[model samples]
Target: MKKATRLLTPALGVGLVFGAMGVSAQSETVTVESGDTYWGIAQGFDGVTTEDLVEANEYNPRAIPIGAEIKIPDGETSSDNDVVTHVIQPGNTLTNIAAVYDGVTVDDLFRLNPGIDPYSLTVGSEIVVVDYNSEFGEDYLYHTVQPGNTFNEIASVYDGVTVDDLLEANPNEDPYELTIGSRIVIPLN
Candidate 1:
């Protein structure tokens, strides 16, 4: 019976690894800092909801000693160069602002402007539109497309732009009929 139990222990552990729990079997260790709780640390990671954290803890909940290493999902690395400042317009809503920029969501805008209430659009307040790593150009108002340019290509030249975002900006113009020297509205970062 002792021999059987010993063999079952490793198998049970492996079974837990492959269980219904959504946590990755391969996890990286994060050190618990002062005032860091499992809930707070878990919330920091994307794709990790509260339930996932609870499930992950079931494996070794008691092991999370203060200053102990705990497994956490990966987090995004912030780039100082990616910051783009934009002045809030009178008619602008948080969602509309997010739609104007590529790779950005309303939640992202809210996160960047911590003190600004989402419900209240404070005109003239500068907000970071997109998180990227690129420099801004001097020509702020517009950009004219040159020959051999696609929506994707144009987006690549500017910071915080995507093909879809460019298309959204120019509702009247056809994406297929992008002519050279045609002016397109560049969304302010």
Candidate 2:
């Protein structure tokens, strides 16, 4: 099997920010997932040192329990909504961001924000880090299927949608055996 590539730099300021928790929008709250370590989290963000992770008592570098929503600092710029934006730094891309946030896809993020130019991403342009409670209408409901695509690949194109969702919606059609030039329905919130 191929090894996973590194995504973002890590930060010591790990914390939680959920709705009704009164946490600001600039931060995020993430449950400690399997394979997460202090060193690993720190390496996900930029300029976060090992010593800083040691200082943040909330995060257990060695072993963090599942379902524990730890605070992830340095996400947003303001405190109105929780969707934080981060400028694309050197070596940053949609692929890297999606890798960092499990279940998120490059197309999912790009579709969420039409303002961004995916093909010509600027080095310092800001991109939304977290897209909570996003709108679902014309942009979210439709999808143009590309060549050599499966229902799973098409489903993974959007963040919230899953292969099961596609299967459920298109009960008659087999996702695996799909035509090359067909329009696929995108499950959206």
Candidate 3:
């Protein structure tokens, strides 16, 4: 029987290991640069979220040290076909841009472009918007609030999800004042 062996290359910041069964695992890492945020790093990878990086690294997302290496989890490779970008024009607002695109909302724009200030739209700057109807992954589902939808009504659509679960997953949202077209996270059971 063969024993598991692990190897890490400091220069490349990659970790590779092979188990007794000859199964191998590799993790890619990125060095933290100045002015980097978890949300900003997550944007470079497809199907990865700020939550995913936080959970994987177990670090304070707000206080990531400069020069620290961050492990990149296994995720889908980013493809240009999966993203749609729009250049900002004078007097353009996220609300109006969303209105021009089918199935896009202000919340979606905000979510896609983190650290964006709605009040400071820069002309010629690009922003991303995604199709809400497209599946992100099995980890969670994105649901847009409708005009007359409640937490209870949303919970009823998914099996084994309660209003409490919804509240817990979305700490920043106001249950009683859900805005129409706002997106919420629906945790999977």
Candidate 4:
């Protein structure tokens, strides 16, 4: 296979507010690899999700050419820090905040910002965010088990990630019996 060419495109309507999760709205290009898909390519990012890919590339989300290069409009992933803080705003809600970014949820927001009183949030209070789009610059993701959470379920949350991939990332543990609150590593593939 030829080397993956890097190109940048912040094509129309793909921009998002960085304040949502501190993700810059700049887009970059990635050369498609064998077996690559929108969902699979999104696994490498925290902010730029598969949905964003469809919107940014202005193509059908379900169909993308493997050898074609596409733009990724997620700002820089991370230089070192794995998390970003979102300052609580007046009338802000975790659910709303999570909706502003792709591949993240209110539960994820809660998980990263522990002990946050959702109802009593101050306008300027800061909360950590585990934005998936930003994880591209990082190495792995940490998933805290909740009641009834399975590897399949967690993998489902992150587009194109599978139980087998998760298992490969964590070889010493039992996927069926994951302990609650225990950390599970989602390694880069």
* Candidate 1 structure quality by residue, lDDT tens digits, 126-167: 777643323225433456556577888888888888878777
lDDT for position 56 in model 2: 32
Tell me the deviation in Å of residue 168 in model 4. 9.4
On TM-score, the stronger of 1 and 2 is 2
Using TM-score as the measure, which candidate wins? 3
lDDT of 4 by residue, 5-46 (tens): 444435344344433444344445777767666656666666
Runs of candidate 2 exceeding 4 Å displacement: 1-81, 136-189
TM-score per model over all chains? 0.29, 0.33, 0.35, 0.33
Error in Å for residue 53 of model 2: 11
Q: For residue 36, what is the lDDT in candidate 4?
A: 66
lDDT of candidates 1 onward, in order: 0.55, 0.53, 0.67, 0.60
For every candidate structure, what is the RMSD over all alpha carbons to the true structure, in angstroms? 18.4, 14.2, 16.9, 12.8
Best lDDT among the predictions, by candidate number: 3
lDDT of 3: 0.67
For candidate 1, the TM-score is 0.29
Worst 10 residues of 2 by lDDT: 1-10
Greater lDDT among 2 and 3 belongs to: 3
Tens-digit lDDT string for candidate 2 (55-91) = 3333334456765655444523234332435556677
For model 3 the local lDDT of residue 158 reads 92
